[model samples]
Target: MQSTVNYLWHTDDLLGQGATASVYKARNKKSGELVAVKVFNTASYLRPREVQGREFEVLRKLNHPNIVKLFAVEETGNSRQKVLVMEYCSSGSLLSVLESPEHSFGLPEEEFLVVLRCVAAGMNHLRENGIVHRDIKPGNIMRLVGGEGQSIYKLTDFGAARELDDDEQFVSVYGTEEYLHPDMYERAVLRKPQQKAFGVTVDLWSTGVTLYHAATGSLPFVPFGGPRRNKEIMYRIITEKPAGAIAGTQKRENGPLEWSYTLPITCQLSMGLQSQLVPILANILEVEQAKCWGFDQFFAETSDILQRVVVHVFSLSQVVLHHIYIHVHNTVAIFLEAVYEQTSVAPQHQEYLFEGHCSVLKPNLSAKHIAHTTASSPLILFSIANETPKGLAFRDPALDIPKFVPKVDLQADYNTAKGVLGAGYQALRLARALLAGQELTLRGLHWFLEVLQATCKRTLEVTRVALLFLSSSLGTERLSDMAEVRGTQELRRATELRTQLRALAEVLSRCSHNITEAQMSMGHLSSELAKNRDQVHEDRSIQQIQCCLDKMYVTYKQFRKSRMRPGLGYNEEQIHKLDKVNFSHLAKRLLKVFQEECVQKYQASLVTHGKRMREVHDTRNHLRQVGYSVATCSTKAQEAQENLSKILDQLSHQLLQDRAEGAEASLLPVTPYPIPAPTDLVLHMQELYEEMKLVAFDLQDNNRIIEGLNRVPSAPDV
Candidate 1:
């Protein structure tokens, strides 16, 4: 071997052979510094010229600390082996933990934060540099005992990653099966008889699965009679089912009366562990992916949900119920919003995945009980929208009273008060007071607490709408269909969904009203993003972002476009990014430009068009007056006189003239970007500016009426 730098290593001890390359634990010949060396299979690599060079370019540019550093590559003209030297891990891969029984106590909650932070930091850096780590999995993650809890962790392997921040879009089959997302099926030539996409999101899925295994003692989707034997495990893993009453997920505790299925997990484990894991994986893995949380947002959403409603959904009548409307609405909004963000930020193939599922178009679920969002009490439906601006809206649908004794599944224990069961509740005090002498003091106290609690919960739920509004949202086709129809079915469905959702809007709007003046006073930096998505063009980065999205989608659909695989939108988060949508992005750009330029002074165009219309109307009236005068006098030559009168009226009105009638030859000059009038043309391009404003003012009431009367329809009539 040729002599090189002291840190360089030379070794032939092959650690493992992947489909593309053989990895060797190497060491520097001079410095004795250890490194992992990956040598590509000479025969296979030679056949894929683009992938080979692309990987080289992508890895060469990487410099993040969390990522496994690639030091150098060596190739000789005569030798068939091409090797890449990378950082080596001593404690071994995360896969070691999954395969080991004693790995239960491998990482504590606080300790895991370090690994997560490192991964996030690396991902942030890569995204900043426009590189996506396309393959994230347990095998690729390595942990070392740097702190008390084996805290130190690093992400290895960027072999399947891409740099679509540029104009290029690559469509290739890639990624491992355990973390493979359904949309990935589109681009993937699934080595097995399964469907998958080989996109950046696959890395996130793998990371999520890895994290789940790390956090819990078991795989989220356990093999019921192993996949190698029964195929159910294979199906479950492939299909990406919810944790669905699994060992680590569901538990039954015997209370004084009976036992109930209790929720005892994190928010990431919500909507089935698969959905939770998929989004987390996307955030950690996809470089250009949408931001899910900062430390605060993640824990706020996670802790609040797991502790109260999101996970276990404890205390419907007392705590969770008081905010059940908010919880349900916000849950729907957040889930939908997450989906939108996912679709927007995801790599092409895995955009719509929340769990392992793609965003399958399911019919809208009908809520048996009307969800009352007004702050009165929890769990119980209160404050129905009995009347709407559309004249008393749909008569309150008969709410199927859920058969219950108002018993909530509290996580707390009454024997010693350890579960979510609250002995400190004031409602029970008020109830006892009512049962005895009906003390006004206790009733007043309960009322105050009830209203205060409802108000707070209402605020939280309502703000959720803002977040949902932040996204392009889901089932837009339903909205479109609702807008055009007048049938009973359309009205009924539209009224219900709109009322339920608007009850969502009311929550946000009310919350905004009560937000402390201090918070309202701050110079919100996020206002930059808030500049109406309609006028998002000011963000110069949008086009670049859209370009990357287009490429991702293309890469995701590579297999299918070539008849290799198939898919729809995502099922993970069950939403789509309007920005990621090709037409939507383009339309938004045009709408922004149109608003800023054409519509900014759009009142002028309205004036111009309206003025022209009025002139035509006035001319017809004058011509009619003239024709009436002309009609009276010449009775002997009535036919000729009438013909002449008609000609004169046509000339005066100009309606039957050169502009509207193509056949009429005009002596006037023709200009496409016409200065409609000669004098105005000479003055300058000034008058047409107010057109949009004029149109807006005139149409404002019409718009208000339409919006007031129209409601967004359900996904489908169930």
Candidate 2:
């Protein structure tokens, strides 16, 4: 039957019916706009006048995206019944969605997050206005499809809502029995003879139940029988069970009662997400009123989760889908690392396509940008490549060393060697005048040789052990191929260890080589001094030795000014300053540069290449599928094939144009043949290049140290 309200709205379609009122889909007669007309039944008018008018006042005051909007309040033309004209939602309530067969277990994680965000936002708006919704459940929440086909949930049916501050309390027994707090359930459902005022936290209990139902497709605190059938037992269970324990209880027709303390196996949420959500549920679902979280805390926690959670859909071969969960604050580098951990695909080999376009994956790319790009089309094509694409190469500042061998001053090096020999000759004479005599000098030289030999021997042993372990970890089958190095955490640690050990070995080897001639000269002078230990005039011998030392010092000063091989030699002042250099600080800066310039840049290139390859692979597979379907002679198939063919033709034309514009094209054999996998020679070459750069950096660092050493003054010429 058609009805008219205030001669402005004409109602014909029934939307829903409840205990107090019935809603109908209506249209405004003047402008023909669709709306929902809610008419209160006569029985509802029996309540207090203030209670009867509260819904209208509350609805009128709300203006949030997650709350239903009120248009007007009027009376029926014939019977004078009160009617509320409000914004209409084309889709039904959340209860209807949960009732679908596919959602028998629960709403998927994506849909559940949407429901959670919307409900939390709507309730936050209510609290901001000092309003309390006594009823919060799936049936009271309405769903509507937005312009972009996204499901938007809105809180509706505010008949039981009223202005109540957080500190204030009301003694009304008005809420669904199953979702009521233990205090409310005892008084309202079991008819306990007591007066208990409900605080704002009562709403939190109902919201917890609603979210639990939306996530798990069942109410929490279920008894063997239904809540109404065994009301006393249900009350006992709700009151006696500790907070966050007892997820639910169930019983078959003739089986034993079973209790579960965790989410069921059928739930689609990942463990990472569940870890975050369980705490929120624990806090809000507290049976102890004092321990329960307030709306402020709830809002803060939910808002934080919304800011950090990002769900991406990755597809391998368009058959299987992986729902990857990540955080919004993660960078592209961290995101790729997470992907590698989960999928076992090296960051260098992964390719992806987002929204039918190839993405340029840069290491510093923000997760926010990635989430935005995939918002409309979340399905990303993923693939693996046998080799890196040429276009994927990126410029790294660490690899920009000039291509020239450092020059050496052979003549100046010879002079420095000769001066050192002459210094040794004068040192034997000076030892006779010394108070400690030749014994102390001989002991110092012996100690120096022992320490140097021990250091060199220990370094060699450690290097050999490290090489053995590295070779064993990487089997002999691919000894030189780094492409087979899985991007695992263990492998990365091992690689770092190898680099450090190799550098230490090289340093020890060079020091041992440079000091050999000096050691030999010192040994010869020590033997000669021991053989001729005659008592000489102390003052005269000291003066003669000092003059020889002065001459040798002058020769070294000239040698220090000339260009020489890095780490070749150092003067007395340079050696003294070397002990004061802050080596740890310099090492930290070098590590920072390597990470930012080399590792991150390479990861970015891998992601870009992977995405492009995925695009091409997907397009080709789609074309093949459409062509096969055309054999069925179906009209839809024929149209799809035709469209795909046109796209392929355009791509061919574009390729030709590119070739004409000076892009080189590779030709493939016409006949089908088995193709061999490409060797990892390029990967090895890259590794070599990185090692060379590290060596160059070390040499430059040594040069700087030498410069600092020269700035310090040597002792005045004797």
Candidate 3:
């Protein structure tokens, strides 16, 4: 084929192909320089028509070290083909690097940092030029290899790039879904109202995702399986907290833990690095586009942590100590620095031992007696220089270190030890002292735990005794027998009243059981609430508890409404036999009968019977009060149970949705405890029911007295 532009086409060097474009390795015939030629198929409607020429226009305006440079563009009228010649990246794209066998899991943190810095620079350049790289993913990031782990990554593929006005929101949902922000999806597909257009922050989010991929060969949110899975992924992106999304991430066997959204770094990372990196990732992955970090903010924040080197100092005779604050890379200078700071010896007087992990950091023994030791791990150890080993032989060995106090001095010595440990010391003596102090503290805590356990057991025992006393009081019997009823009409009326009382007692008893069942349910629910509150954000659990309480309140109101039923209320008009129920009149009438019929013989027995009758009467009144209490308490307990169920259901739903570790077994519905409220009510109600039954039986047996006391009952209405 004839040359379309100044560059001669190398058709045989087929680089790569997309649906709408074909890229080839080409050379400028005049300069004999290698370049990439992308020829767009204008006939394909898949790509926007504006993209055919806008990419070249955008690339021409951009000039940055990390951005690919455009040479020239040519269009053939006959073929209707548009071709653009641009800079060639010999090492290919970052996609290749990630897919390579050597780096399949992910690039090392150091190497990935280089890639990130370059990408950020390129994107910043684009932003400065008022352009947004709509499709910023791994395939578009090109890499050029250089010497000694040095590589220049250039942002390529401007086909989807667009220039926007300030404060503009990108309305289109065109980028890869995994990288797209939730708001963009909502605005484009879901059509959620009040959604502002996404801007450069979109790029920041995509970059964060790209960074995550570089650090770990996986996406934070991946679409899996079929149609249902797609929706689930979308829903998760919208609702679930990003930190929780990375719960299933596992650390690689050889490399760092998967740098996920929750916790990006591993425990092996120094405190300083962790402090720096956590904030950076948070800024980038923030769901709100407006809040995401700009390139300048990202670079400024991450520069220190990314560049800082950790130095692990080990005293061969003592324990290993990690020092991360040191910025100086030169081992001799660092060694001298550490000598003055860490030990009480001078650099010239001390002989140091240094070991290196990488080629650049190899310790040159000839220069400073530093030994070249290779380490498979990233831990870099530097030994404290020993000055005069023989001089220590003259010093008293026992006096050299302080003895551990078997008993901590509560005054001056304790304060001094506490201060020393709090400040922390590297000396072997101090470390040993700290260990001894810790042991003492642990023992103290153990003693405290034992005391607490005893206290709890004692409290439980006291509660049990109180419950037993309360329960026993309800079932106590009176020491008496029932007097006889003499009249048929009086006996019939007493029997009817007794039958009604028994029915009322049964209803009250059922209420007690209901209340108890509810209370037990709520008790179990409270336990579940305690557990779920720990795993989730406190706010969510708190809100859930409030909702349950609200439901319980409503249920309680309903129960209270039921308590006002006419059957539960006492009706004075419903009482038929007032003479039998009126203890004052019955006592006078019974005394008159005793006086008339063999007064001398029955006088002593009459006194005992009167006392017993009064006791029985008082017991019956007490049973009535007990029944009322059971009804009221049972109502309250049932309401509590409803609330408890609601709270438990909330917890169960959260547990299932979150699928938190160790929660798989909780997928089944929560089975509430057998509530004590109803059972306690049952006990009280049963006692009242039995007591009332006895009162009714006695009243039925008193027919003789009831008739004899009211002799004119059959003659006329007295």
Candidate 4:
């Protein structure tokens, strides 16, 4: 056990422990900065000094962006407690992330790719230095957290690293048993030192196994069987392959309760990604070491997919990087290989010589002075080459094609193709009409001409005046060659056919030019209609129209995909973006149809409301008239009653006067005044009562109609 009394480095905390070492989260007393001190467990590990020495030497010579840095080493106490101080990685090892049951399936495929690329880069660096990391697993890969959601992965644990001579291999086996290559197992089984030994290929196999474990929570070749598990795993490594295909199948039970929208199915890799990873695993896991890929071959084969990753390298820097384009994808390895071939600089020297700065522009040259430089900013250049030394514009031998080839304009090509399709369709329609003996309309002819003109403009722009002469000349030339063998009858038929073809071609060419302006006008109209439809405000009607449009877009995309074949030469990305045939026209039509439907429904409701409103108005008018008539009749009846009363009272008073002078009135005949009978007045009063009853009945009916109108709800406002 290591004693803490004489320790040079102050071990603040224990980070992790292994069979041979105990890694501590420590503080350097002199520097007063945090660091990771991996103390050797002297009692557990045999030849601890040898392992410690090898690690120290490997770490001392190796300095890479994707490899952990070694700060210092110390040996103290009677136990010879040796400690290797290294840069502290805040985020910890990749194994911790991969092993966490909570997030095992939640880990993203992109994160796996990132980790793989970093390890590959680091391995490539190590291989260039003639060193092999016998052990490569998730446990040895550290993650460095950075600002702005960026991270840097680094290869750690160089305890098993060994520098070898050219094509050298070690007879003794080392590293985690589960990750041991088949060749390592075979050699161990043979128990022979003269046989082919294990080399860098073993490390690659280990890397493959590590990736498999990280991607899926389970090991590809399960290591089981208590004490004999290691032995069984080794035997299986030599004999058995992983079950299922490259990425393996995913079970729902293996994942969290729910997956994030951005992630793919749990533990399942995309085909594009699998295409890159499968080969690496397949080759590295081969029984024959020679068949396995070197770092160069591995990187080149995977660059197309692996290069999709964007890494940010940052430090204390104020300079803003502008217009950086990363054109390098495993090109640095190619450059180094070229340098080793043409120049005296060793591959190891070239590695240190070409340490890259992310921001600065690398100059173009053959092979300039090479020196180490560090990244100054978190810049991921997609179209720039920073890994190559400045002024060394060495083209990668692996990349036969140009790096920055322009993408084909599939959208424009598709549009041009539609014109041809329209013409063919119109021509077919015309032919059918002729066969049916039907008269063609002017509009039909106009459409046929416009479509044909547009098609010809894009596809066949041959000179019209020259076409006739060329056609005749070609026919005549053919006839001259067959003149001696053929009779005049055949010659005449050939000449007629050629003449008809030439005439048709001439007519089409002329018509195309004549209708060019009309086609342009139609195209303009279509564009404007599309624009108007797009700008329409989104209401329920518009939303319904948009749903139709979305369906159309999806159908068009599927149709395009179905039509695409090997030799089509269409850019899939661009062609996918193009709308289907007459999509914009369809969109405009959809908007028009939906809007018209809404308006018609609204108008119908308004018309119905108008009818109801008129009924209410008429009922109101009748009620007012009835009220006026009733008031007028009532006043007339009162006046009649008053007049009758006055007449009766006058008669009574005159009679009294007559009684007082009864003798005077005896001579005069007692003729009564012509006054109407009381029966007549009673009849008039009865007629008035009947008329009031009728008026009341009409008023009550009108009031009921008004109440019904009030109860009906008005239509919703547009």
Give the winner by lDDT. Answer: 2
Encode model 2's per-residue lDDT on 268-337: one tens digit a residue. 5644456567788878888887889999999988887677655454433222233455677788787777
Number of backbone-clashing residue pairs for each candidate, in the order shown: 48, 4, 16, 10
Q: Rank the candidates by lDDT, best first.
A: 2, 4, 3, 1
- TM-score of model number 1: 0.35
lDDT of 2 at 136: 89
Which segments of candidate 2 are over 4 A away from where they belong? 1-12, 252-259, 311-326, 330-718
Computed on alpha carbons, the lDDT of every model, listed in order, comes to 0.38, 0.57, 0.47, 0.48
Per-candidate TM-scores read 0.35, 0.48, 0.43, 0.40
Lowest-scoring 10 consecutive residues by lDDT in candidate 1?
A: 389-398
Please tell me which model should have the higher TM-score, number 1 or number 4.
Answer: 4
Q: lDDT of candidate 3 vs native?
A: 0.47
State the lDDT at 53 in candidate 1: 73
- Over 4 Å off in model 4, which ranges? 1-12, 48-52, 77-80, 186-196, 223-234, 242-265, 308-718
Model 4 TM-score, all chains together:
0.40
Please state every model's RMSD to the true fold in angstroms: 29.5, 39.2, 40.7, 38.3
- Summarize candidate 3's per-residue lDDT along 1-718 as a digit string, tens digits: 5256576675678777776788888888789898998887755445666766678789999999999898788864458477888999998899878754234335655577687678877887887899988778888898987677589999988877889744776666656666666676555545567546677677877787777677655555543432134644453544344542332222232222232444333122333344455667667777755566676787676565555555443322122233333444445556445434643444433333332121122233222333332221212221223222111111111121232233323232222222222111112222232222222222222222232233223322332332332333222121000002122343334334334334444544553444344334434543443443343222232233233334433333433344344432234222212211232232233333323322322233234323422433343223323333343333332333333333333433444454556644443333343222323534544554444344333323332222322221332211
**Model 1 segments more than 4 A misplaced:** 1-12, 76-80, 104-106, 145-150, 165-170, 185-199, 227-718
Error of 4 at 563 (Å): 58
**lDDT at position 666, candidate 4:** 51
Residue 606 of candidate 2: its Cα lDDT? 39
